[model samples]
Target: MSIEIIGLDHIQICVPIGEESIARHFYLDLLQFTEIEKPENLKKNGGFWCKAGTISVHIGVEKIEKSKSKRHPAFIVSDIEATRRYFEENNVTIKEEIPIPGVSRFSCFDPFLNRIEFLEYI
Candidate 1:
């Protein structure tokens, strides 16, 4: 038998315990993702679910330790420049990425230091 991998169902990003509100502010307000109800059974676990287009983001709570890593979720945006400016206007920390031919991209850190990439094809 052969195994086939399917598409991504969701991406989970963790924030410190009791910091769901902060996560909500960033994902719901700043990023403008729509909130989705969690399963009744899963409500016991802190965090919330949200989606923008086909991307579903699950913000969960945990005790986090600072780390320097390049792991992030890259989101395809309609206007990269506008997205960059929006983050700047909101005081979000933006990271400049190496130039890629035919693509405009940059990264920014959320309130919890989770890096997110925004990109648009040129």
Candidate 2:
């Protein structure tokens, strides 16, 4: 028998405990993602949900520690240059990644230092 897999429903990234407001500013205000309602059962756990295009992002509350790694969630954008320009105008430090054939990509850290990547196919 073969195990069947499906598409991603959501992606959860962590923020420090009691810092949901900061996360809200980053994801909702800075990124312009639409806020979504979280179920009552999950509300007590803290954090909130938002939508970026068709992708749902769960900003979860947790104890965060500093780490130097390239771990991130990459979002495929339509215009990588415009996205990069927006990040620059917002004073977000951009980290260039190794070149991938036919792809233009870069990454930046959120308010809490979680790396998020943005890319476009050329």
Candidate 3:
């Protein structure tokens, strides 16, 4: 299937509130990716952008009337144990430990109670 598109372009995720610093700390500091700030007009829409390898993730926020941030994103890692240990060192809260049939992943919550899953794809 040789066409115009070769591979992935980017991935976008949404956050409930638009607190970008937290996102930077987790994505840039704790995890990975280089922080990319959102434009003034885009900031009002909530979130920022980051680049890792050839992929980009757009973290957006929403303003709901009630509680928000119930959604979570899953990340694929090379080593599950190593990543889990890192999370432990950071004192991150571990929510669930389940191995997917194909991929190995452990879901957890951040300081803001946002669910995230770290998995090993082998």
> Which runs of model 1 end up more than 4 angstroms from their true locations?
1-6
**What TM-score, computed on C-alpha atoms, does each candidate reach?**
0.92, 0.94, 0.70
Two-way TM-score contest, 2 vs 3, winner:
2
Candidate 3: the clashing residue pairs are 15-60
Tell me the spans in candidate 2 whose CA falls farther than 4 Å from its real position.
none
Worst 10-residue lDDT window, candidate 1? 64-73
lDDT of 3 by residue, 50-92 (tens): 9876657787677633333657666778798898889889998
- Report the lDDT tens digits of candidate 1 across residue range 14-96: 88899888889999999999999999999999899999999999998889886645767899999999999999999987899
Q: Tell me which of candidates 1 and 3 scores higher on TM-score.
A: 1
lDDT of each: 0.90, 0.91, 0.72
TM-score comparison, 1 vs 2, better candidate: 2
Tens-place lDDT digits, model 2, residues 1-122 = 89877877898999899999989999999899999999989999999999988899999998878575566689999999999999999999999999999999999999888899999999
Residue 3's lDDT in candidate 1: 86
